[model samples]
Target: MDFEEDLANDSEGALLEGTGKVASNLSDREEILQSLDSIHSQINQELNTIGQAIEHVDAEELPNDIEEFSVGLSDYGAELSQFIDEYRHNLSAQSEYFETLSSEEADFADITDGIENVNETHRAMNAHWYELEDTLISMQEILANFEMPTPQEEGE
Candidate 1:
């Protein structure tokens, strides 16, 4: 199945069966990890773009761009909040989705690495920026993936 795609299209409706309106964009445990990684990359890329733009920005141009990006980040943060809300909603179910990692392909490791990227990007953003956008990243969501490995290793 298109595992990664599964997360992106996760249903955003209220979880009548379990938790509150937490964003659980995943039907499987691996999807949780996958979604986290996907977000991690996106956030990192945005941060990098902001950082680079800031460096060469004219003194006069910097403030305006910063404000615009800050607003954009607000929108992004809201989106992530929704995603997490969905995530929590899914996890609220008593039937845990965790299983032997053997179900996942090696490509899934790329998702785990994406989690690390979240940590690194968070750190870099924190060091560089002075606004909430710099540190608004959720580190644990991505870090959680490390415990879930690829299918090959889990089979052993």
Candidate 2:
């Protein structure tokens, strides 16, 4: 092939490779969002279950300190649940943004902008995840301070 033809062919190959990478990235992001949705659902379910259990607890039978602890647990559970819901909402918004970008006949600059938005979303998500992790660790510490009676002793 002539030099011009060879250069043209190389450019085409590179363009195709770039497009392929973008498509792959889109697929990966979709998968991550789906997984997040699934996790959010599971967390919501567990939180609801815990709330139900707390509701069933006989408040009058609990020691004053334990009763106060139960209230705190319920409040924290509610706050955590709200945070999860907000995270899921943000994910949905990001998904919609991606969908809009993908459906458009975007140029390189538009695609670059989309990628930047995705990166920002990722950073925000990571930060939120870390915050949640820290909150969970704190909750664990709080629980560690509490002294629960053994089942056998409770039966006495």
Candidate 3:
């Protein structure tokens, strides 16, 4: 082949290779999107469950009864915010290939950090839930005091 013809063939090969990579990347991104959608739905469902559990709770007494209920919720808010930040970082880190996206070098680091952050959030949320349960128990005890009338009242 003439020098120009050979050069033209090589350029075409390179273009084809790069186009393949772009297509592969788009497919990997779509998979990542699907996984994220499932996770988001699961989290939303869990949050809804928690909301339902707390729905009938009397919050009017919560301000006075639970010393740190508001503070605890604030801390939970911070943890959730941090989780979102890490999740954004993780999602932006995409793989170059469609087949091996999870193990790929491009996304491994961010994914690791994101998983850790998510794990931490799970732990924090669990602790907060227990804390809330304790608060509810205490409130129930306060309300239960009505079962025992004072001796003076009984005598009267």
Best by TM-score: 2
Candidate 1 — number of clashing residue pairs?
8
In angstroms, give how far residue 43 of model 1 lies from its true place: 2.1
List where candidate 2 sits over 4 angstroms from the true fold: 1-64, 149-156
Model 2: per-residue Cα lDDT at residue 118: 68
Runs off by more than 4 Å, candidate 1: 1-33, 59-66, 78-82, 92-156
TM-score of model number 3:
0.29
For every model shown, what is its TM-score relative to the native structure?
A: 0.31, 0.48, 0.29
Clashing pairs in 2: none
The lDDT, on a scale of 0 to 1, for candidate 1 is 0.44
By TM-score, highest first, what's the ranking? Answer: 2, 1, 3
Output the lDDT of residue 70, model 3: 36
Better of 1 and 3 by TM-score: 1
Model 1 over residues 1-156: C-alpha lDDT tens digits? Answer: 333433333343122222222224334654754676577567656556555555555445444446465456656655555555544553443122222111234256644664455456546444433343334543334334423223334335
Clashes of each: 8, 0, 0
RMSD to truth, every model:
20.4, 8.1, 15.2
What root-mean-square deviation over C-alphas does model 2 reach? 8.1
Local distance difference test, per candidate?
0.44, 0.55, 0.44
